[model samples]
Target: MRVTQHLWFEKDMQAALHCYISLIPGSSLDWQTAVMADNPSGPAGSVQMAGFTLGDQRYMAIEAGPLDSFNHSFSIIVECDSQAEIDRLWTALGEGGSYEQCGWLRDRWGLSWQITPKRLGELMSHPDPAVAKRVTEAMLKMAKLDIAALEKAAKL
Candidate 1:
């Protein structure tokens, strides 16, 4: 059995796919095709099917509708190299969208993303669990995650 992310877009599947691929490193769009079928609402061929990669994960995007709702329970987390990288990603993903604290943003397409720095994990995984918890608490209070601050918290 294989698992892949299936994303539903209200109208901009291609735009969302491209935007994600652009922000993510080493990512690419693999295929796009229209599937023809006979059904209600619109038609089977009404859907635009796309295959893309985000980091190492595979995802499929469909622009078929009967517009639906999206919520916070699902999100894509990107691990970055530095604060600069996090900022870059946050700005790109947050354009035309609102920002929330702790390195989270909702993209224009209403997709939630966590633009996290790679070192944050190492800092939070320090030898002392209390330090790690401190780092976690520090992270929870910030909008954009700062690697330096996280490291400082771990050392405390």
Candidate 2:
């Protein structure tokens, strides 16, 4: 079965979806506009939901009002092939946004993302569980996951 992530935003579902589609690769906007129940005063069609993709994962954006807020507890993790890839995503995602320590950044839309190197998993899931635990511990303290730091911890 195919799964889709649903994002709830105040009233910028269309704008946010477009922004995401522009920043991410292989992303496109889909679906027609619908009026949200919360905004009865707005124009006839301001767009309530839009389908888009950040990577391979498809996501749906909806105007769910301003009740809920975004936090670091839940974040989208992007695995990159090289340091250049990490830099590209980090720079693009951090545009008009806040930068946290390590590789975590809050995008302009207030979405938190972890731009990490793909090798991170390899290092963390190494042959030795004890070493992996150490690497995991090191990763927990940083905002961005550092491959070198994780490897150092794993080797230790």
Candidate 3:
């Protein structure tokens, strides 16, 4: 069985798909289709559905009109191996978007994402409770997570 995450957009399904696919490595747009008949959402030939992949996970999107919208309750978490990786994704994804505390940000499309460094987990889960607490405190004060700052906090 294959499980896929589906997203509904008011319009610009193609642009959104392309933008998303370009942001991640090993991602691609698999297929897209336009409705042949007039639908409630739009005229015929409008974007009906599109399929894409982000790092091996398949996703589908539909131009279902503005009946629904994305919320912060759901977010895609990208785990980065290093600070550089996190910085790249954070800057790119946060373009025309708002940054939130603790590595959270809302993309231009209103999709939430957590561009975090893998070392964050290690620091947050240190053996000593004081170390973990320091790391957590440091993280709480930042929009984009800084691994070096977190490490320094842990050492204090």
lDDT of 2 at 33: 63
What digit string (tens of lDDT, one per residue) describes model 3 on residues 5-59?
8888887777777877887889999988887888887789874898899887899
Residue 101, model 2, lDDT: 74
- How high is the lDDT of residue 102 in model 2? 59
Count clashing residue pairs in model 3. 0
Model 1 residue 89 CA deviation in Å: 0.6
lDDT of each: 0.87, 0.77, 0.86
What overall lDDT, based on C-alpha atoms, would model 1 receive against the true structure? Answer: 0.87
Worst 10 residues of 2 by lDDT: 36-45
Off by over 4 Å in 2: 36-43, 137-142, 146-156
What candidate 3 gets wrong by more than 4 Å, as runs, is none
lDDT of 2 by residue, 1-156 (tens): 989987778876677677667867787776746764446535545546677777688887777567678788778988887777777778887889888975789988788998988887887788888988887788878875666777788878
Which ranges of candidate 1 are over 4 A from the true structure? none
Estimated TM-score for each candidate: 0.91, 0.76, 0.90
Q: Count the backbone clashes (under 3 Å) in each candidate.
A: 3, 2, 0
